[model samples]
Target: MAETEKSGNAFVETIKTIVYALLIAGVFRTIFFQPFWIPSGSMKETLLIGDFLFVNKVAYGYSYASCPSLRLQRFGIDVDAKDICGFFDGDNTRLFGGEPERGDVVVFRHPVSGRDYIKRLVGLPGDRVQMKAGVLNLNGRPVEVEDAGTFEEVMEPQGPQRIRPRCANGAVGDGGMCIKERQIETLPNDVQHTILNIGPQRVDDTGVYTVPEGHYFFIGDNRDNSLDSRVPAAANGVGFVPYENLIGRADRIMFSSAGRSMLFFWTWRGDRFFKAVQ
Candidate 1:
């Protein structure tokens, strides 16, 4: 009986050690290096639904890069609560880094409902941003378009049948197919990036907006199909994120999976591993 008790105790101790190690690893991952899984088509060609991305939480600043431009002094500290839901304590954590550059990919808390989203920076404070004929214009420069190619998007089937959009015989932007091949280049500051255009019409193109100080103007690369700053703050979209909502920067794409669901790991798209974010 004595020998059996010793063996049981040994097994328990071994299990305890393993559990503790795993718990610590989880803490490190969630705090510093979190693995973000793409769940929607908002980031289309750049990031697929099953693509798992690793975000560098320390790139911009602390957990919440709430500080103003790395140009201005950081916000300093949290003195009051914000939002009715109490989502975040509004702790104005500051940092001494440079402001987010034009082409940097950022993650921030949505202003309307406090949800988190990933998007590319398009306009800085005091800059004019507009989307006309499906092309994003900064200040006065028209973003150039390039045909990168097509992608198979798996989305919810459209609603009931209705009068289809009239098709004119010409290039897409000129008026042709519904969701055809289209691309454009947006020059934010001096950095340029590829933007996919599905069509020439979008409801988000309300009008020109001048990004206010202490806030940033953002939009998704998949212009034709993303809910972003274009929507008013009253509509539940991010309405010019304040420095307090800045999360971090997407430094790289760790891995991506194609058609297959995230459940099947053995069939992951091995070719996408270690691809740098452009």
Candidate 2:
């Protein structure tokens, strides 16, 4: 019996240690650093397929951190509205912290698919956004595009067979999908970086998407390659992102590797360090 009692005590202590460690990690991930992986090429050139990044959790606003832990009043009655359970069990939002700024790289829930997407917020609420001849435009003004020099071969397209190939989801592409490679483009600053561009095969295009209030319109830096707010998602594209759907902000690339090759820490990137987000 004594042996069993000692074993029980050990198990309980182990559980407590684990719980404490998890709590600490969660706190760090929430207030300081959160890790995310690049899933799609939508934000290519800025972020790549295998690139792993860290987001600033406090950059946007508090998620669950904003909630009051306990009622402050001594003799207060419980309010039903404050106690109402939401769609997802624990996640709840009372109010927002900060609004996303122009040129800020952000991660938000997709309006159509309800998935997370990292995009550069080009247009904001009450902004007249227009895309013409590969140039972005604000209210009667061009959104400024500069000619940054060149970058190394970064993103690799699927392959020649993918051209006109039924998209991964079997969405038919305009025969001869597109041939793309590395090229240079002017970033927000005069700093140049290699961006992806497709030749003569834009599958989607639209006109004058007026960003509604409490929402934002986003597009990929790879203009011709991305199926962003321009194309219809019912077919396959991001529409408009509401303010409430925001997750957090993509602040910096913590690390980069050639493949899943994370074993060799030396092989990790040293150049693409703390770059001010685009």
Candidate 3:
């Protein structure tokens, strides 16, 4: 009887230990850092579709929005009087922190949808932003871009052909036919990064956008592909993101997988492990 009692006690103790460990981990994750997975190819070469990265919570300080524990209290503005969750409306305060600088890749809450979004900070408050024929113009000055060579993606095999060509010029000229224009773009602050131009898309040219106060303009490195601040909010694009919705900056990639399934060990991208997000 004593032996059985002791065994039961040991099991209870083990469960208690696990619960405590989980609580500690949850608190740490809520306060200091959060993990995010890249769900799309918007950032492209800078951040791949299968990349997993860490967002430093302390980078912009703590806010009601930053704590997962307080998610229920995070309110949103009513898009229309008929919308659900329209009753709750107010702004959360961000305590102690600085604003994001140009070229910093950040994660924030979408203004309308309340979904999380990650993009590069291109324009600050009160900066004039425009894209004229694939070129980015900030405050009336054009950003400098230099050719950085071609960026190619291997097309999925269809039937007998193992590798298919999908170049920029046509349907299939050569194995490396469908090429994207890659260039090194330097921001006004001297922060340099690579951007991809996939020909003249809808957002390649845009009218002048004067950024309002307390809001920032964001864009993706995949210029021709991203639906960023260039697109209007009415069109389902992220408009000028407010300061209150700011989350944190992505510091580095923790791990990456070429294949979406994590169960496949062979699909692990060893090269991107611990790679810093520039």
Worst 10 residues of 2 by lDDT: 159-168
Model 1, span 1-278: residue lDDT tens: 99999999999999999999987875665456656666555665566556677777666655333321111225564332132224534554445434777778887777756556888888888888887767777887766666666543323221122112222223333223444353546474556566665556555366888898867888887776678888778876666877667667777778776534555577477877887776
Q: In model 3, what is the error at residue 64, expressed in angstroms?
A: 2.6
lDDT of 1 at 187: 75
Writing each residue's lDDT as its tens digit, candidate 3 over 142-228 gives 999999998887654322223232346556443343567889999999998889876777788888999888788999987776778
Model 1 lDDT at residue 69 = 18
Best of the candidates, TM-score: 3
Which TM-score value belongs to model 2?
0.71
> In model 3, what lDDT does residue 141 have?
90
Mind giving the per-residue lDDT tens digits that candidate 2 earns over 166-265?
1222233343333344455443434344455544345333477787777787877776667676665666787776665666788778766544446656
Top model by lDDT, which number?
Answer: 3
lDDT of each: 0.63, 0.59, 0.78
| Over 4 Å off, model 2 | 27-32, 63-96, 154-195, 201-205, 264-267, 273-276
How does candidate 3 fare on TM-score?
A: 0.84
The alpha-carbon lDDT assigned to residue 267 of candidate 1 equals: 48
